[model samples]
Structure formats: structure tokens, C-alpha cells
Target: MNKVSMRFLMSMMLIVGGYAFAKAQSAQSLLKEVDSKVKSYKNIAIDFKYALSNEAQGVNQETKGNVVLKGDLYALNLLGTKQIFDGASIYTIVPEDEEVTISAVSDQDENAITPSKMLSFFNDGYIQKMDITQKVNGRTIQYVKLTPMDSNSEVKHTLLGIDTTTKHIYRLIIVQKNDTKITITVNSFKANQPMSANAFVFDESKYADYYINKI
Candidate 1:
């Protein structure tokens, strides 16, 4: 090769390398951007539709409902089924048996799906890998798959579908060790809205014939 040709090739390669470096964004930067967006809201409330499939339990349940969530309290309501927590107690209403199952706050299985516990997840994970882009939902998304580094945790893997437009968690899919899949899709949301204490408190004194099951 001629000296002139070799010089030109080296210059072209440097130019291309610089361009690529300038274009690529860092993983931390992408997660920081999403974090900034999420931080805009002090608290969150969303109306979601959820599907839970527990292969071990042989349970497949699809419940269309709105969940009102804040710190310590979360209330989930479907057309008929209702679940509420007043921070210390969890009350699940079973209309089929006409009773509300009241269980104390502990290491119960139902605590994993409680609204308060799940929302705390946003502050918990570090982005192992992140590629930011737009999805069919029209929100700018940081489509990330996470492995829970916490061994004592109930959730195994989490797939977050964040809304770029709203900059909030649009969809959260949680997979457990027992092959139980819980997917919560946020249809709409409001932040810092006034929710009654009664909203998280299940009052079933009115329903006399209902049966209560404690876990």
C-alpha cells in the first residue's frame, strides 16, 4: 500500500469511531433519565387490569380492576372481587361465600401482590442493561429485564414497560419462582390524589352472609 493511501484510511477510521462513540448513550444515563421522569411524581395512583397465572396452584385468574395505591395502603377492586389493606390488616372479600377474609400483616403469600409493596420496587433495582426507545404504546420506553439481586425477595424477574410520554410505569410484569406470573397493566393514572382512608379499609359488616378465609 502507498503511504498516502494508508494515511487516508487511518483518518477515515478515526472519524467513524468518533461518530459511533458520540451517538451511543450510556446505560446509566438512560436509567437516570427514566428516574428523573419517575421522580416527578411524589406519589402514584393507577387504575390497572391484572392477570395472575399460578401454574403450581393451577390457578388462572384475570381480574379487571382499578388499584388505588399509596404508602402502606392499597385497594384493588374488580366488578365484584375486592381486596384492601389498612396497613396492618388485609381484607379480601369473597362474594361467593359472602364473607371477607381478614389476615394480619405478616409474611403471608398475598403480601407479594399488595399495591404498596410493588410500588416500592421502582426504587429497588439497578439497570443491568438498558436500551431506550419508543414502543407501540407510543411512550418513550426503557425496555429492561431485571434480575432481582435480593435473595430474600419473592419476585424473581421483572419486565418494566415504561411510558415515555408520561414517564411512569405503564406496565409491570412480575414472575415468581413458583412460575406464578402477575402482570399489571396501567391503563390510566393520577398522582397525589386524595384517597379516603376508607378506600383501603374493607368494611364488610354490611355483608352478613359472606365467609372469611385467613391465610
Candidate 2:
């Protein structure tokens, strides 16, 4: 090829590379801003819709849940169960079975994304890239795709949608290796609300009729 043609091709490559790098940097900065805003809140309460689907397996489920988080503590209600993490131990209450299981936080799965870590789990173990931006219900939602660094992880990738104006998370979509997809969409989000003194505490006396199993 001619020298002029070669130079032009190289220039084009450089331009494309530069744009890709800038896009990556922008995604990182946006995530950092989201993390900062989440940490600044004293506490957060969220109501969300949950969905799980696997087309190949013909499995589909949908539910609604709510969680209240403060520091490392969180109370979550989902799938007909209530789980409370009080920084030290986790108490899971199942009304249908009339059972309550108590276990130490250290005994829980290390990779499991608990309610307390839901918003900030992307801070580690992931490669972030800016994705598409869409208009949803008159709100601009910017998406960021995260690929897990762990090769053995069941998750294939995750798409996090952030509200551009509020800088708050709007939705999370997790696609697994087995083609199972889990999506969580935030319906309501509130921060720094007045919480009861025992919001994270487990009151065993109230559940006298239920069987308590401590692990």
C-alpha cells in the first residue's frame, strides 16, 4: 500500500482507540459518583420488583420486595421470607414454615450479594464499560455493563441502569451462564428516613410459637 494510505489507516485506528479509552474512563467516573452518593446516605429504603426467567428451562417468576439498609445492617423481605442482617448475625424468618434460622454473618456465602451490598457490589470484581442510554418513563437511564473478573462465577454479565438525573440505581439485570436472568427494578427509593431503634434487631420473644434454629 502507499505510505499516505498507511498513515491514514494508522490515524483512524488511533482515533478509535482514543475514543474507546475515553468511554471506559467515563464509565468508571460515573460509577464512582454513584458509590459516593450511596455512601453519603445514612440509611436507605427501597421497594423493588424482582423477576427471574430461563427460557430454555421454561422457568419464570416475578415478585416484589423491599429492603431497608443502614451501614452493614439490612432487613430484607422477599419470597415470603424476611431476612435481617444485624452486622453480626443473620436472622431469617419464614412465616409459612413457622421457622426462624439464625447464623453468623461470617458463615454466609462470601460471593452472595446481600441487600446491604446490593448497591455497591460493582465496586470490585468487575470490568465496567459504558452501555446505552434510554428514555424510560420520561427519565433518562444510563446503563453500564459489568463483566465479572472471576472466570468461575456463575454470572455472565450484569447491566446496571442508573437514573441520570438522580445518580441513583434504577435497575439491575444479571445474566447467568445457564441462561437464567434475574432483574430487579427499583419502584421506590428513600434515604435517611426515621428508623425504629430495633429496626435491625431480632425479637425472639415475639416469635415464641416459631421454632428457632441457631447455626
Candidate 3:
């Protein structure tokens, strides 16, 4: 090959290699940024507008509620109804029926420690893979897929809608093994706020009457 032809071929190879390297680096940086932000917040409480659809069962439910999660304690205020997980016990309050069901955490294997379970995600065996970017309400989000390394986990895989500009998790889609999909949208989210210890407690006496269930 002549000198000009050799230089041209080398330049093309360099360009291709540079593009590939940049793409890989970008993905890594985004994942790292996500981890950093999640790690920084130890406790979080947010109000969510949730849409749940069970395709197999043909059931759809929509609910709006305020969720407070502080470390191990948690509570959900929904439609005059409340569900509280006070570390050792689980309490469900229904105002209409004027009843409360209290169950031990050890007995209830499937407890909701998710969005309301305010523990910091360790990001241990979870894998973060990049997906396609899509526009949500005019905000362009980079799709990042998350799969738990442990198969025993209740969650199948979570699709995260990450705001590219703010680099925050706008929404999360959680799919259970039974194919139940729950889309949780953050109506309003605030992080690192000084949550009073009282926030996580369930005021049982506030309700008119409550029932107890052991099992």
C-alpha cells in the first residue's frame, strides 16, 4: 500500500475504536453516577401515583398514596387506608371498615419493603444494562435495565426511567414472577430530608377501631 492509502486505513480504524471506547465509557459513567446518587440517600419518603396491571389475571388497579420509609420502619397512607410495617410487625388499617390487621413480620414472608422499604439499595449482584432512550412527558430518559443476580428475589427485572438531564430515577417498572407489572411514578420526590422519627410510627389509636391477626 502507498503512504496515503495506509494513512487513510489507519485513520478509519482509529475512529471506529474511539467510538466504541466512548460508548462503553459512557455507560459505565452513567451506572456509576446512579449508584453514587442512590448511595448518598439513606432514607427517603415519597408520594407515588401507582398503576398496577395484572395481565394474566385481567386486574388493574390505580391508587395514589403517601409512602414514608425510614431505614426499617415504613408506612403507606392510601385513600384513608394505611399499611404500616413497624420493623417487627405489619399493620393494615382500613378506615371504611374500621378494622386493623396486625401480623408479625416473621409470619408474613412477602412484606412490602420495596419503595416503602427505605433501605439503601446495596447494588450488590444487581446488573445495570443500558437500553433505549425514550421520551416521557417531553423529558428524554435513558433506559437502564436492572436484573437481580439472585433468582430467589421477588422482582424479576426493573426498568428504570432515568432523566438524562437531571440524572435521576423518574419512574420504575417492576415485574413480578407472576407477570404482575407495577408502574410507580413519582408524583413528588424529595431526598435527604430530615425525617422525624414519628414519621415511621403507626398511630393505631388514631383509628376508630382495629382488628388483630396473628399468623
Candidate 4:
């Protein structure tokens, strides 16, 4: 082929490649926008309903929980237990057992989803794609599907539904390889709520008679 024809072909290929790159990057861009909106608040409080189901195993459970997050500190109440993270350590209190467990955050635990990571976990280790949009209860929700990059991971895929108008998360559905599915739906979301500096601090005095385990 002549030099002029070769150059023209190469330019056309570059244009096509650039367009494909932009399309793939759109999902991540939307996620980043959601993260920014979430982080803008001084604090966030969320009431969510958690559901787990497995057809083969015949297991289905549903529960309600709440979490408050500020910076790296968080207070979570789930499954009849309260967990507090004060940036340095985690304190887990079980009311029925009247016990409290304290532990330092380890490297392995860093990847665990905390209240702060819930909105931003899709930023890494996943192939994200814009899925579908639906109107529920008069609000439009846009869903983004994420598949784990690691083959050995138990998670099959995750769907994150976001309120398009508010830029807030509406629901999250996680499917596992074992056919187990977990869904979390946000019932209420409040941001910039007044919170004390000691919101995440664990006061040992309150659980005087409870068994204490430190690790």
C-alpha cells in the first residue's frame, strides 16, 4: 500500500480505539461522581434493610440495620450487635451474650466492607458496566453491574442501583457463585447530621458486667 493510504488507515484505527476507550470509562466516571457527592457531607447516616436468600439451601433471612460514618470512624448496628470503629480499633458488642470484643484493625481486614467503603468499593478490582434504568415509586434508578476480576473470588457479580437525580445509592445486590444472593436496600439516607466527636468511641464503663475479650 502507498504511504498516504497507510497513514489514513492508521488514523481511522486510532479514532475507533479512542471511542471504545471512552465508552468503557463511562461507568467508572459515574461511580466517581457518586463518591464525590457522598464524601462532601461531614457525616452520613443510613438505614438499610439486608436480605439473604439461597433457593437450593432454602435459606431466607431479612433484617434491618443502621450505620453512621464520619471519616474513618463508624458505628454499625446489625444482626443484634453493635460495632464501633474509632479509627484505631474495633469494638463489637453483643447484647444477648453481654459480651464485647476488641481488636486492632489488621491488614487482612482492610479489604472488608465498612460503612465508608460501601459507596466506593466498585472503584477497584472490578469490571464495571452500565446496566439498566428503572422507575420505582416515581424515582428513576440507574444500575451499574460489577464483576470481580479475580477468578477465585466467591462473588459472581454485584449490581448497584443509584438514584439518578440525587446521585445517591438506592440498593445493592450481590450474587455469589454458590447461588446465594444478598441484597441491601437503603430505606433512608441522611447526610451532614449533627454528631458528637465521640460518636464512634466505645465506652467500656457502659458494659461493666459484660465479658470482655481483647485481641
Candidate 5:
């Protein structure tokens, strides 16, 4: 090619490369801001709608749940079950089965996104890229696409949507390798509210009739 054509090609490449770099930097910066905001809160309470669907399998389910988080502790209630993580152990209480299973938090899968880690799971083990933005309920939702770095991970990709005005997570969409999609949309988010002393504590005595299994 002539010198003029070569110069134009180089200029175009540089422009494209620079734009890509800036986009990545912007995404990382936004995520950092979100993390900082979350850390600033003493605690968080969230009510969300959960949906799981697989068109190929003809499976669809929807439910609602709520969770309260403080530091490494969290209390989650969903689908007639309540799970409490008390910084060290996890207690899963099933009302239908009338059973309570206790297990150490260390025994849980490291890659599993537990209730306590839902907001901050993207801090590692994933590649973050800025995705599309949309207006939801008069609020701006910015989506970040996360691709798992582990090739063997069951998750195909995840989209985390943050409300730009509040820097709070608005929605999470996870697509599994088996083509199942799970979506969680935040209906309400409250931070720094007064919590009861026993909010994160499990009272085994109250479940005297239920069988307790410790693992």
C-alpha cells in the first residue's frame, strides 16, 4: 500500500484501540463507585422478584424474596425457606420439611453466589464490560456484562444492572451453560435502617419440633 493509505490505516486502528481502552476503564471506574457506596452503608435490605426460565426445556418459575445483609451476615427468605448466614455457619430452615440443616460457611462452594456475596460477587473471577443502558421506571439502569474467567464454570455470562442515580444494583441476570436463565429484579432497596438485635440470629429453640441436622 502507499504511504498515505498506510498512515490512514494506522490512525484508524489507534482511534479504535483508544476507544476500547476508555470504555473498559469507564466500566471499572463505575464498578468501583458502586462498591464504595455499598461499603458506606451499615446494612442493606432488599426485596426482589426472581424468575427462572428455560424455553427449550419448557420450564418457567417466578417468585419473590427478601434479604437483609450486614457485613458477612445475611438472612434470606424465599420459596417457603429461610437461610441465615451468621458469619461462620449457614442455617437453612425448611418449613415444609420441618428440618433445619446447619453447615459451616467454609464448606459451601467458593464459586456459588450466596446471599451475602450477591452484591459484590463481580469483584473477582469475571471480566467486566460495559453493556447497554435503559430507562426503567424513570431511572437509568446501566448494565455490566460479566463473563466468568473459569472455563469450567457453569455460568455462561451474567448481566448486573445498576441504577445510575443510586449506585445500587437494580437487576441481575445469569445465564447458565444449560441455557437456563435466572433473573432477579430489585423491587425495593433500603440501607442503614434500624434492625432488630436478632435479625441475623437463629433461634433453634423455636424449632423444637423440627429435626436439626448439623453437618
Candidate 6:
């Protein structure tokens, strides 16, 4: 190719490369900002709707849940079950079975999804790209897509929707390798809410009839 043609091609490539770099950097910065805003809250209470579906399998399910988070501690109520994390041990209470399972927290488990992880899990092991922005209910929501670095991961990718004005998470969509999709939509979010002193503490007295299985 002539010098002029080669130079034009190189210039085009440079522009495209620069744009990609800037887009990636913007996605990271926006996610970090959201994390900062979430961590600043003393406590947070969120009511959410969860939906899971697999079109190929004809499986569909929907549920509503709520969670209260304070630092690394969290209390989640879902499917008639309650899970509490006291920063050390995780207490999972199953009322239908009248049992409670206690286990140690394993931060090294990358596949585990907890309230804290939901906020900052994209910090590592993923390539983030700024996806799209949409207006819903008079608010602007910006989405970021994260593809796992591990090819063996069951999850194909995850999309996080953040409220641009409040920097709070609005939704999370997890697309699995098998084409199963799980979407969690935040119905309501309350930050810095006043929580009881023992919100994250599992009181056995409340479930006296339940079996306490400590592992």
C-alpha cells in the first residue's frame, strides 16, 4: 500500500482504539462512584423483585424479596427464608424446614453472590463496558455490562443498571451460559435508614422451634 493509504488506516485505528479506551475507563469510574455512594450509607433497605427464566426450558419464576445491609453485614428475606450475615458467619434460616444453617463466610468464593458483592463485585475478574442509558419513571438509568474473565464461569455476563442521578443500583441482569436469565429489579431503596441494634444478629430465641445446625 502507498504511504498515504497506510497513514490514513493507522490514523483511523488510533481513533477507534482511543475511543474504546475512554469508554472502558468511563465504565470503571462510574462503577467506582456507585460503590462509594453505597458504602457511605450507614444502612440500606431495599425491596426488590427477582425473575428467572429459561426460554428453551420453558421455565419461569418470579419472587419478591427484601434486604437490609450494614457494612459487610446483611439480612436477606426471600422465599420465606431469611439469611443473616454477622460479618463472620452466615445464618440461613429456613422456616418451612424449621432449621438454621450457620457457616463461615468465604470471601474467596467468587461464585457466591451476597449483598456486599452485588455492589462491588465488578471491581475484579470482569471486563466492563458502558452499555446504555434509558429513562424510566422520570429517572435516568445507565447500564454497564460485565463479562467474566473466566471462560468456565456459568454466568455469560451481567448487566448492572444504576440510577445516574442518585448513583444507586436500579437493577441487575444475569445472563447465564445456558441462556437462563435472572433479573432483579429494585422497587424501592432507602439509604441511611435507622436500623435496630441487632438487625444483623441472629437471635435464636426468635426461632426456638427451629433446629440450629452449626457447620
**True-structure Cα RMSD, model 3:** 5.0
lDDT per residue for candidate 6 within 88-159, as digits (tens), equals 999999989999999888633747567768777878899999999999999999999999999999999999
Candidate 5 structure quality by residue, lDDT tens digits, 157-187: 9999999989999999999999999999999
- lDDT string, candidate 3, 106-127, tens digits: 7754334354432234244566
Candidates' TM-scores? 0.67, 0.98, 0.69, 0.88, 0.98, 0.94
The candidate scoring highest on lDDT is: 2
Q: List the residue pairs that clash in candidate 2.
A: none
Error of 5 at 185 (Å): 0.4
- Model 1: lDDT equals 0.69
lDDT of 4 by residue, 1-215 (tens): 99999999999999998876776687788898898998798899999999999999999999999999887789999999999988888899999999999988773254455676888888899998888899989999989999999898888999999998899999999999999999999999999998887899899999999999998
| Residue pairs of candidate 4 with colliding backbone atoms | none
Residue pairs that clash (backbone atoms under 3 angstroms), model 1: 98-210, 98-211, 99-210, 99-211, 139-164, 140-164
Runs of candidate 1 with Cα error greater than 4 angstroms are 1-43, 52-62, 78-80, 109-113, 125-127, 131-134, 150-156, 176-180, 213-215
Give the Cα lDDT of each candidate. Answer: 0.69, 0.95, 0.72, 0.90, 0.94, 0.91
Off by over 4 Å in 4: 1-23
Give the Cα-based TM-score of candidate 1 against the true structure.
0.67
- How high a TM-score does candidate 2 get? 0.98
For residue 67, what is the lDDT in candidate 2? 97
Q: Which ten residues in a row have the lowest lDDT in candidate 6?
A: 107-116
